[model samples]
Target: MKKFAVGIVSAAFILGAGTAVFAAGTNNSDNGFSFEKMLPFMQKMHPDQPSRN
Candidate 1:
């Protein structure tokens, strides 16, 4: 019973530490998707459609 408790505690600690590290390492600078960036390609694909700009 003691060993099982220790194992559970250790597993929880490792998981918590890993999650913290992953959260800290994330980048917040991503611009994600931009319709303006895809505008030229979209215009080429369908010239008849009016642009939203």
Candidate 2:
């Protein structure tokens, strides 16, 4: 039981750290915008754009 708990904790820690690293490594300014991050500009530029399923 103790080992299982430790493994779960370690896995969570690793996933969190990997996410942070990945976010840090992203360009964040590609194509003059980060579509995933800048919603307002996208709305203005492509108001007619259809929503993704």
Candidate 3:
């Protein structure tokens, strides 16, 4: 019984950790960048896109 409880707890922890890692990369702006900083890189990489400014 003790081993079973420990196995359940370990599985929960592993699943929770896996979810947290997956969530970290889902948001593109996770690092927090502003338009001013992002615009130049975007413009250089994608010259075809019309700049809103």
Best by lDDT: 3
lDDT of 3 by residue, 1-53 (tens): 99999999999999999999988765666467756668889899999988776
Predictions ranked by TM-score, top down?
2, 1, 3
Over 4 Å off in model 1, which ranges?
28-53
List TM-score per model, in order: 0.52, 0.57, 0.51
TM-score of 3: 0.51
Model 3 alpha-carbon drift over 4 Å, by segment: 29-53
lDDT of 3: 0.84
lDDT of 3 at 20: 99
Candidate 2 residue lDDT tens string, 18-51: 9999888776576445767688777788999986
Model 1: pairs clashing at backbone N, Cα or C within 3 Å: none
